[model samples]
Target chain A: MKKALAMLLLVLVGTLLFMGIYAMEGFRPYGEVDLAQRVSQAYIDKDVTGENPEVVYGISKDLETGSANLVTSIIVNYRSFDTLGEVTVLFLSALGVSILFGSFKGRLRSRYQPNFILRTGSKVVFPLILIMGVYIFIHGHLSPGGGFPGGSMIASAILLMYLADEAFRIRIEGFKMTEGIAGSLYVLLGLVGLTLAGYFLSNFLNTGTVGALFSAGIIPVVYVLVGLKVGSELTGIITDFLKGEVE
Target chain B: MINPVLLIAIPLLLAFVSILYKGYRNNLLVFGALVNAGLVLTLGKGEYLIGGFKPPFGINLVLDDYAFLGLLVINGLFLLITLMSLDKIGENATVLLVALAGLNGLLLTGDLFNLFVFLEITAITAYILSASSRQYQHSFNYLVLGTLGSGLYLFGLILLYAVFGSLNMADLSLKMATADTSQLVIPSLLIFIGLGVEVKILPFNGWVRGVYGNSDSLVGPLFSAVYAGAMLLVFGRIFAQVIPLGAYLKTLLLLLGALTLIAGELAALSKTRIREILLYSSIGQSGLIVTLFLSGLVFPAVMQLFNNILSKAVLFTVAGQMADTTGTDDAEALQGAFARHKLAGVAFTIAGLSLIGMPLFYGFVSKINLLFGVFSLDNYWLPGVILLGTVIEGTYLIRLLVKLWMPGEEGLVSHESHATKAPLEIQRARVMGIVVLSAVLLVGGLMPGMIQNNLSESGRLLDETTPVYLFDLKGGQ
Candidate 1:
């Protein structure tokens, strides 16, 4: 009976979905020109001319936030509130994994470690990987890579070291400090913006000449903090996953 | 003008900072909850812009009556539930605070994408907390379902953004009102499917029973009351207001809601376990609330949600205590429950009665309002369907009450008590929490006028604020 009911509901839903699709009008595919007629057009306009003189006339993403990369501007500046939420999502996942794996008191190190060559190579490449991650986040406003990607990169490097040396203990204390400080700094900066510019997470600081490494007001600074936070959080999650729970 | 952003910010900050103070984590959670409750109660209404940018550009945080009510419910309940779960939720305290932050963001965000982000945060945190119990498979199932729901929800947002070229709720609403609504059909359906999963509407709620049953009972109220309440209101805001519901869509919601109501009631009627019973009833109540909202009975929808929060808070907390004392959560274990614990038994009876929509209870008013809404819509059959569901709901709930008041079995010991035991102080604290919840329910039942007036005003605000334009910010700082 349950299966029959399920099938019946499925058929109804499928029919309704089909009717809905058939009824919809003027829904264009991605990159259609009609999109240029709506609000995103203003964004595109601002992206091209650096000013939208029609709607919020004379206010442009370039002039207001000064991030050359549009996605970075959107993620870090235009909708930083969502970015904060995304950070919380990562933080919660990490906390959850840690709690799940935190039951065992003793460390459950890997039974087999990598060979000498792999260990030696990981040790040599770890700092270099860290530098690259830092660079990616720092240049986030001007380039493609930003906090999330950069953080994942750094965490993967750390994971490599863990595999290379089973006894290489994670200084959870340092990671905790880094994650806390970085996450709190993002909120603090937003609050600071509230005080300075009367808007939460506003571009309170000066947006230097565009295309510069240090430009885009607080975007780079926030992204850097986000990078450090995500890096530490991902490292913590990976660490917990490596230590499987006892049966 | 308090920045409503601070509500989300402060909790998130404390959640991260509490990690540093591992020894005093509970203290940090308590402090955070207290501050949030206070701020939410005192914060004035206004549009608070984020990133110093205007709407349709930078995200705006709304502080209207709808958002205000959600804030109060979430933060207020968090403080109470925090007190209840203090000893039980150890390292999971941070997750709770973060989840509260996500909920606050969900209530306050004026941007569609921001809503999606906060929804993901809440879903992820819930998944982690739910999976922390012995039944990992259930939580895993919940996580997979929730993630799929969120994926579809995000896809819907993309479609909306594609058609309207905006992500702000108000902007999208304004555009959708003027645009060809036929163009919105697919997107709206996608969103309904997505929100259906989150809000536990019928067949989409394959996850409800296991997660509620297996998780720590102390946190059960948080799921059934706080999380479910906020999500239902958001569902109303987005569907009943943001998108102009076409006739076909309205019929879809109404039928689905009535079907869900019957399905939930039947499931609950067949169940003899405590958590499963509450879980199914909760789903049934959500269906009723959704039906109310879809029928344009704003007052009853809000009233039902408020009443559900109170009753569930009372029932779940008391039920958790009953389960803890008796060892098993089965209905048979409830025999002589009143003899063992008088306060919990009475609390359960009053709350159970309210759930049955008895006279002098707030549920009675909500049920009347729901009936009026169904009739006023000129839908004659819906009332019959609703009444039938209520009858089934009442039969099982009354049966449970009888079980609770029954005499003890001589020489029969509860077999499960030996497995888990909590200290006396924790038990006392939990019962105290139950007392507070039941007190509110009593006060609400006796003076239904006050809460009804307030909820009606909120309902009026909800009705008036269709196409909520929250971007008219005044001078700040």
Candidate 2:
């Protein structure tokens, strides 16, 4: 009876809400007179020309931030404040998982260790994967991949080791310290931008010539910090998940 | 003229550093909080363009009058809670600091997406902090509900961005004026639901009880007083500035607020546990604040919010102590607790009187203001409902007081005999914290005029700080 009543009420409210929404202007069938398309039309034009008065000196994001990847430029330089918060959210999630699962204190291991081939393959492939992760973040401003994807890549490598070696134990404290330092530096760099220029997280350093590896002022630097911080935090989370029980 | 970003950046820096220096996490947090409080005090009002980017292109932070008042209340409550919970908080100190950073961002950020990001920061850390209790499931519930609400909020932002083509509040306000009103309906509802979740709007707030009931004594009040205050202020800003409200929207909010108040009061009356009663009362008070807010009475809404914060801080802290001493939160178990813990009883009585809106209490002034606001609208039904809720509120609180002092369980009723009936000792520090809060409540009530000028100024500032006015100011700078 209760379930039926709830369903009935839900349907009623949903219908009323939809009816109300239909009464508003500008909402039309998809692909018909797309009003939303015009909203970002100016931005798209700026993205193409690489010049918009919305930024400093009418310099394009490519010239100002020097990041080839528009998304990377957006995430790290133009709207870095949101990225700061996004990083904290990921860090907090890791912390919460660890708090609930406790630090892995050499607890119960896998029931069956991977065969010899799997173990040997993971060990040999680990450093190569780590280097790839580092490369991604280092080239975040000039390439497709950035901090979050790169960090997850490194964490995946660590997860491979956890699967291969049943007795391998990570020193949770060391990982924690790395995460903390990297997170702190991200903020410190933003503060540096604040003191050097008038704005917080402003590109205080020179926006080197476009397409250069060392370009984009603090964009690449912040991305690298985020990459390292996210990598270690994710590793900590995986280790906690694999560990059996919390004390 | 301190940079408002430092309000967020400094504590985050200290919190991160404290991880490497665990032994000093508590002291580091305390020091950082004091610095934050100092910065907020000296901070001048302005719009801070982040990354040297202009509005409509980059995120900005604002420190207008409403935000300044929010900062003071948030920082003041955080300092008190940190001092009171230093010994009991354990590893949660870092989490608390991070949550404070999130709250600061929530109050100051000027963009819609940035607001969403800060909302996640606050929710994630609060989930961890609230999960410290044995009821871990409650934290999981909080995570699910909070995430769902934020998801809806993000969807709304996407819709607004699609139609209006901007994420900055000022920019959006400029475009939204001519945008399709039909396209905005879904987004506005989504955002309202998202922000309302934090303020404990009814029907959508299933996780409230589990969170408030399970969090440690200090954290419960922190969530209620500081966290809720920030969220409420943000909600008010959105309605007053970002989205111009239609009559239909206002009426919808008013009805929801009335329902929430009645439901909360009835739930409080039904609950046997003392902490649960206080939790429901907290919800009811928030409901009252929301109702006044939706009525377009910004001043009285803020005043009521202040009263709720001060009184809840005292009530929740004392209830935590009482529960600790009695070993159970059942009202029957707390009979004669006044004899054993005189200080707690005194603090509870003062806070209770304030919550009941007795004359000479801040609650009384705020309540009268709210009534006037409602009466001016010629809305007899709302005033009638409010009076009914208040009557219901008075009956339960008075009943609790009787149970508290009327000795030996004579009028007290218990479903089961509590095992740990012996009164445990109370901590001097917690008692001291409650005494300080009580004094603030008394002083605020006795000298209401001291804040009248500032309150009216902030109330006027609330509407004047709209996006259009702010956008004009931005050009001069």
Candidate 3:
């Protein structure tokens, strides 16, 4: 009865949200809204600080924000502090897992024995998976995939190994060190910006050209750090959970 | 020239580094806390932009009067709580460091989305802190509710962003002032429910009882003073200064606050357990402060917030100590727990008295100002509700204090012979910390002038300092 009532309430809420959103001028059926009238346009145009010409594919030089990916420009450049915070959220979650499961001695053994190909296949796949993860985070400024997804991909590789071979255990201490170093470097990079310039997390490097791999000066660097931190933290969480008492 | 971001950054840096040096994490936590508290003193009034971008475009940390004062009190209390309970911190030191960063971020951020990010960071750290008791059930409940609360807040914030196309607090306020505020009602209500969970409003605070009731001395004071104070200040910032509210929404929220206040006090009145009483009292105090904020009485609301948090810090510490020592916080079981520790006892008594708004204590100053603020707004009925809540609150607190201080049977005179045998062992550091907090209360009550000068002089925006700061920003004098 309670579940039914809650479900009904949810449906009512969904209906109201639809009505309310459509009623507002800003949310006027999404497609009818002018992109030029939006704040995101300024972000894409790279004109928050000073005026800029239209961004080009591989030609825009010394733009305010240098990321070709508009989302990356917003997440990494315009509002990097919030990204830092988002990373801390994941870090805290991983820390919570370790704290709760720190005392456990070893990994939980799988109930079924792994097949011959499965164990061998995971070992083969792990390196390839790690390279893919690196690629995703490295190209985060020019592509849709960023640190969060790339890091999750790395953790998924770890998870695969754990599933395939019951005795597979990576040293969590290494992951902890990686997470710590990566996180500190991210902040230190921001502080460097603060020291040289007057702002924090400032892109103090040369923006050669848009659509280039070397472009978006600090965005890629921060993304790489985030990828490392998130990867290690997620891996730590996975190891901690595997160490939990199996039912 | 010290950026306010360092207050947040230093702690986070320490927290990240602490993960590598597990043995020396406690030292890092202490160093970070001291640095943060020291840095807060140097912060003046201005907006510090991040990522080298301007406001409403990039994130900024606003060091307005509200944020500056909030940072001072929070970092001060956090430092004291951390130093006093170093033994209780154990493995939770790094978690505590991250929590400090999160709290500072919560107070300092001017971007709504950035605030949500800090909110999540703070809430997640709090979830870890809550799990320290090993009562996984309550912690789980808190996790679920807190996550849901933040989600609702994000939902509301997304709606606002959709309408305004901006996330900066000052920018949003300017836009909201000119917009049709009737469009704000649903999103406003959603935001309230999100904040209500953290603020311990009625029906939304089911997890407070178990978590707070089971808290140790370190977690107790930190949660009560530091976390509660930060959340209320942020609440005031968002609702009072930013979100332009219409008539119906204001009334609805104000009523919710009043109901929460009355209900919290009534429930607290019936509790026999010392920790439960203190926790419920905290809930009631939160409600009153929220009501003050909703009424647009910023000064009195801030006064009450600090007063409540400071008093609750002392009160919860003592109660938690009792529960920690004797394994039970039953007021009857732990009768005369303070008989051995006279200093802690006096501090607890003073904090309780102040909380109940007794004369010559800071709570009295806060309460009087609160009533005066309400009355000046031509709010007649609220005073009646507030006074009635105070009377009930006093009755329970005094009864608890009397039982803790003097423990004779009902038929006989209160005597030392009837003191609790439960071996209450409050450390020297803890005692000194509570004494210092309670002394501030006593001194604040006597000299409210110092606080007033800070407020009237430094708190207001666009004062002499802001013009200079803006001139510096625009690269001119």
Candidate 4:
């Protein structure tokens, strides 16, 4: 029966691939597809809500979405609700980790004592990594990196601290507080848009020049909240994992 | 007018607040559920856009009658379940808050990929809720299947977006209406298999046995009723309304639903444990509803889904409570177990009888409409199989009800003294909640018009066939 099922699945897949490749007009070959015909063109040109056929970096003023990075403009500006949902997804995952390990005791202790160099190095490196993470999220609307990568980087820094110094315990309550406050402020910001403007997550701020540091309306602010929330959430998960369960 | 987006946002907001004020998480959960339930009632039928952008460009919440009906029932039940078992929500209040948001999003989102996002959020919370049993293996099993299911859903959705260059459901439907549906075979099938896992179609439901069987009272009703109902409603929304399918693929999926119905009933007939029987029954009902939707009987399909989830909520709660208290759910071990808890027994009996499609119950109304709808399709064989499945369903459910109500030696004189000594007690709050639900079933059963009116509301919005009342209706033709 299992063999027959496997055969059935194989036949099905093969048939689909053939049909998708040959008979499907909608499935045009990749490069032949016109980006101008896609909705993404509007995202790239920042012409979704209004006609800004051209979005020149550091030139266009008071355009629809001022995020210079097209991806950030789409993810954080055009469809910010989906991004909020994505943030909640990561938050829920980290929350799941904490709940499952809720019964655990203090941090997991290592057998081998780390050398002075490794411990000292993680401490010396931690501040720099933190700053880099902050920079990435702060410049998310202008550059490639955003909340998710930046937050994970911050968590990685905390992981380094754990590895190097066993007794170095960052208080988990502080991280939880950070996670909660960041997440709540994110939603509150969206609500503020809903109240002042007519839409949730509306770009209610003065969206200045595209490439400027303080532009992109609510995009940078959202990314900053997302970064803090993700950073604290991942840190909370790490803390829960490290804290061994007690009977 | 209430913005439908608030239904998805407030719970999320409260959930975020919950993590900060951990001490007040349960209070926040109740408040969120209350706020959601209250908000949904005031919401009118319209498309509410997010980010202040037009449809086909930005995300929107479609609060048509179908979505409104879903929001009404799902939010109502979420509120009840939270109130019913607030004590059981220890350490998981944040998860419930997020789940409420996710379930609302699943029902309301007009964008397909946005639906996938909600599906993931809801699925992850389900995994966390399942783990509340401390049966990590079962939760892990559920986690793997659910993740795979959502991934496939996303894959299918991405394909659709790539093909049409849009993610809006209405726009995609319009696009697919013009395009050759034959080309859509793979994406539609991929979507079917993806949603099939959560909808509990026969082959894709390996996690049901472990997850549902191990879940306690709080998690059981929420999963079986709220989550299951929302997913089935979404299935109807997508398959029956959105994605136009070719004749061949349509027939193929119809046959799959038929197969699931029969197989689910047969499997349920063989189960001795309470929750397992109900889980299989839930699958069977899902299949029956899926078949109805695919057959183009949207009204009956949604109504049948309503009946199934409503009854399953009561059934699973009692069954889960039994296992929680007695540490076992074996039917023989729980014989006459409901003797002491008469109110719970009555609720269980009403739910069971309704599930068996007994008259003057909501299930009977749905069953009649379903049979009428199927017969209207001139599909004789499926109705016969449905009848046979109903017989098997009735036999097992009645047998189980008898065992729970009357305990004695096999063919000898029955006595209350013969009841099992297993001490079990339903909480006052849970009993009240189930009583309220059962009363709704009874009321819905007696006044079929009340339910039909709501069905017609959506049918009119959908521009589909109007729901048929008891004997015949204006739209039966």
Candidate 5:
């Protein structure tokens, strides 16, 4: 009985305290007289000119970046560093798994390999998936698909090979080299930005015609690099995991 | 066009690839770390709109100072810790990397719902890591508490979305600042209780010790270094942006911190196991940092608080290393170890002194700053309790040290002869890293100006035109 009363009292006290805070907040002034009014007003006023019109114009016209997708322009060109970090995360994960699970070299335990129809079907789908991934990467600036989705599609192609052929094995060395080169190229591009533009990832090169396939100063180049890095790194990780456990 | 969406996409892409690496895992791990670090370092100062939409309508990823600083700490330490865990964790490496990606996503994301998704990813991976060792009882305890915490946090988000009709942090902040306070009262309380699980405040920190005690030593350090650190950053961001009830929140935080510190110290003094002692110590230290932050001591104090965290991480890592070498983490078993492995012993001593806030170490500088800040605020009782707790903390640490070094009959058995020497090259590398880190801590302690400058810059980044003075009352009040 004592314990139950103590618990009830604690709940009551907590409720009262919460209510008091809420009441105090209710009694405070609202709307035009609020403390955060200035910041909110500044935000609201921004829409009058469609959100920092001058800054937008400066990016589009003065910067000569013809990409209609301003967000893509900023990510690929202005803040490619973040994208690079994202890529590195995947690469490191693949490396860690391979190091831990790479030693196993056992023969196949399967009683039977895949039948002819399944193998043939996988082979037929492989080229289509690869082509689709390339299309996604090339048209990233104009469409919904970008480096990540495209890269995953490419990994799926590799997955097809693993399923179709019992003797199938990915070229680990080639994949690693491709991953390294892609990463290096991404960094080199940033360094180039430092020289050509004012900042490390600034896009100051020529902005091609807007809405065109070849438009966006560095968006296409960045997407291509990211796609390559992602594709290789994903393939590597999948290969490592699917290789089975080592004793 | 470079969209912030790419940040999320790039890692997801790499995670897919990680599934394919049949061998050569070390190369992949190193490659990932380098790539992530490069990206964070090179991420230029700018805001990226999501899907070419403006803020208040479309989402925005602000790559401002807060995000930048968080990126540096999370990515930098993440790489180092990953490298450190290479030999220890082995095959579970890919799972850890996936967790890292989830953590990074949690930090960089602007959408509240997305944050929840990322949080789940991190939590799920952590659960797997914790439960990997089947014999560990603490892992089960951690799962129970962690699950409860996640459920509460998710419930809070649901309530918040129902009230505000938006899931973006910036939008929530703006709406919350002006909405009917009565309507928000329940949601605010719910969110507080939910995040409290991660913050490990009083009543909520019940599971932390069990979790840390049961996990692999390497896993514990990473949890402290990355998981807890990221959560704290997230808390700070939310506090700065969303919460308008600053004074009340600060008071509650300060009181909880004081209580947690007292409880943690008393618990640590009673613990016989080495891992338990470290776990309690971390809890107490975390509480201490949070206390300083909530005291509203302004810029200098916040900087001091950050410095304390950095030093504490180093100390915890060193302690872990000492345990690895000695074979037994038990204070009774580790007695007389100082005479044998002199280098590790010296490292342990320095780290312990730093923890105790000795005058020459980085811990001392931060502690003094914290005490001074508290004193200036005329919070006499709070500082008194902290000082008393500090004494208790010193007593146990000193006792452990004495047992390790002092020679006596039937002293702690010498395990030095039986211990296998770590590779000479690995030892050299570890020692070098420790020396560099300790030197930096020492330099920062001696010349407080260097740290103060960085703190000022950080403060300016937090809010320009706001002087980063501890005693400043103009805007804080």
Candidate 6:
């Protein structure tokens, strides 16, 4: 009864506080209506009322990086730093798991023996998954998919192999080297901006013709680097997790 | 427009690679710290525009003296703490790096929403770090309180965003300066009160003692040093930029700080355990620092203040470690520690004196400056409260020291000393680190003028009146 009364009192206090704040500030819900209007305006402004009639209207002109996709431009250019940080977060999580769980010989657990049908099916689908991952990364600038999604798909390819063959394991050193090289390449690209354009990560080199595969100067390159880095890091994490308890 | 984005990016990159190559965790940490330090040093002062976009239109990272000092103190302490814990905190090294990255990002970003993102990362890492050990129930309490704190912060951010269309700090500052005063007041209160959880201000800091006491001793240094230091800087930045509401916010902070000081000191005095005492001491110190900052006592003299905070954090961490090693954090059980470990005892005494604001100690100088700053503003009561709180602080710390060092009857040794004997080399290294830090603290205290001059040079780079220091990118006027 005491606990219930305390909880009731707490709820009452919270309600009062909320009501007081709402009364003071004229509380409105998450501004969903405003966001929707802005997004719609963005679409309409780009398509119908835009200056470039041939290239598609109303959408923001600033987002014409070889990719017709605005989300891609936002992810790869406008908010690339956020994406980089996010990828690094995943990598760090993977590393933490590995450190917590990995062993010297990488033999903390025995390989799982799979049935023939499942192994055969994995063998058949592995190449397809790898192809899909590559396709997604390559066309990221023109589509919804980008580094993180594509990278996970690539990891899925590797996961297929682990399932298909009991003894199969990707070389850990190779993954490390790939991750290192990819990360360095990304930073090197950013540094290039510093040297050539007088700013870090500045995409000043080429505007390349919009809606083309090779446009957005450094966007594609950055995406590729991000893809490789994310792929290798995720694979490393999964490998560590699979490796079992640290001795 | 190389924004302070690199500060976050560099550590993130290193953290990612550290995981892939576990053998080089220490090297990666060092490299990350050095790179961040060098970047802050060379980036010069003034805001860095992002994406070639001008602010109010595009978000920009401000690299003023306040931020520069904060970055230096946080990153510098982070590097030291990582090095100190390399052997002890094995396997958890990468998480520490990520935590550092999140902290630096929190300090460097100018976007409010981005701040939330970084805050989440930092809070999550802290939760993991705090909960790494399952032996203590305090970790669970910490998790619950910490989650509540972050949730409150998020709610506050959402409210702030609703009031103003933009989330960029610079834009928000301008909006706040002209917005409806009544409408704006409540949001500001929410924002400060919400973030106050991490700041450990009064009413919102109930979890601090439990959290700090239960976490690993090494983690305590980072919390008090980098985590708290960076959050304080962010709080300062928010207040400094968002004018019109500055006075109200300042008043709120003053009251909170005073309350925190009294509460913390009182709690510390009551606590018998070493961890509890240190935890409460940290809370009290935080309150004092916030009081100084809000009272505008540190402004225009912020460089000196920053130096004080940095040294004090180091001193507190080292003292906590000493407490850990002696096996008992209990004042009664710590009898004879001074004789048993003379060097550590000496270090602890100096740190204690500094905490109590004794003459010739760094804390004393900083406290005097704070007192003068507050007195000039004609708020005499705040300083008196601070002085009284300092006395309370002195009493407990001294009592602990006397009990540890003074001759007494045989008592039960602390469980920590017997659980697993620390390697002699590790102990020696810790002692050495403490010695070095304590010496620096002493030097900073004894010769404030010299350090003040150097900081003034850096301060001039950002803004003259700011008083905190940075490298003048445009040229030192």
Error at B330, model 5, angstroms:
1.2
iRMSD value for model 6: 5.1
TM-score of each: 0.90, 0.91, 0.96, 0.95, 0.65, 0.80
Maximum-TM-score candidate: 3
**Candidate closer to the true structure by lDDT (higher is better), 3 or 5:** 3
Model 5 agreement with the true structure over B352-396: per-residue lDDT tens digits:
677788888777877777777777786768889889889988988
DockQ of 2: 0.54
Query: Which residue window of length 10 is worst by lDDT in model 3 chain B?
Result: B468-477
- Residue-by-residue lDDT tens digits, candidate 3, A1-247: 9999999999998898778767766555567656565578788678999988888889988888789988999898888898999998999999998899988866677679999999999999999999999999999999899898999999999999989987787988899999999999999999999998779899998766888999988989999999999899999988898886744
DockQ of each: 0.58, 0.54, 0.78, 0.73, 0.06, 0.19
CA RMSD (A), model 1: 5.2
Fnat for the candidates in order: 0.82, 0.72, 0.83, 0.76, 0.01, 0.12
Q: Please give the TM-score that candidate 1 achieves against the real structure.
A: 0.90
Candidate 3 residue lDDT tens string, B1-477: 689999989999999999989999999999999999898888766778998888778898888777887899999999999988899987888889899999999998888999999999999889999899999999999999999999999999999888888888877877778888767877888899999999998879999998898999988888888999999988988887788789888888888899989999999999999888989899999989998888888778888898999999999888888788888889887778777788999999999999998988998888888887787776667888888889999999998988887888755798888778887789899999999999999998888777676566663454453231121111111
Error of 5 at B359 (Å): 5.4
Model 5's alpha-carbon lDDT is: 0.62
User: Worst lDDT window (10 residues) for model 6 chain B?
Assistant: B468-477
Candidate that beats the other on lDDT, 1 or 5, i.e. the better one: 1
Off by over 4 Å in 3: A1-18, A245-247, B410-412, B463-477
Better of 4 and 6 by DockQ: 4
Q: For residues B1-477, could you state the per-residue lDDT of candidate 2 as single tens digits?
A: 689999899889888888889899888889988988888888877788898777677888877766777898889888887887677787777888898899999999889999999999998888888877767798889889999999988977876775565798877876777665556667888888887788888977889999887656777778878888888888876765677555677778778888999999999999878889988988888788778766667667777788888778877777776665556777876765666677777877778888888888777877787787778875879999889888988899988877776654444463224323556566887778878888777777898887776554443232354545331111110
lDDT of 1 by residue, B1-477 (tens): 788898888988888888888887788889989999999867877777897778878798877766787788778887898897677786687888788888999898988899999899988888877865657899889989999899889888888876677898888888888887678778887888899998999868999988887645556888888889888988877876687778887888889998999999899988888888998999998898888777766656776788888788878876665566556677664555565567866777878888778877777876776676677677777888889989999999997777666644434543433222322122767777777777777777788788756644543232244335321111000
CA lDDT of every candidate: 0.79, 0.79, 0.87, 0.87, 0.62, 0.66
Share of real contacts kept by model 6?
A: 0.12
Which of 1 and 3 is the better model by lDDT? 3
* Chain A TM-score values for every predicted structure, listed in order: 0.83, 0.80, 0.92, 0.91, 0.72, 0.75
Q: 3 or 5: which has the higher TM-score?
A: 3
**How many angstroms is the interface RMSD of candidate 5?**
9.9
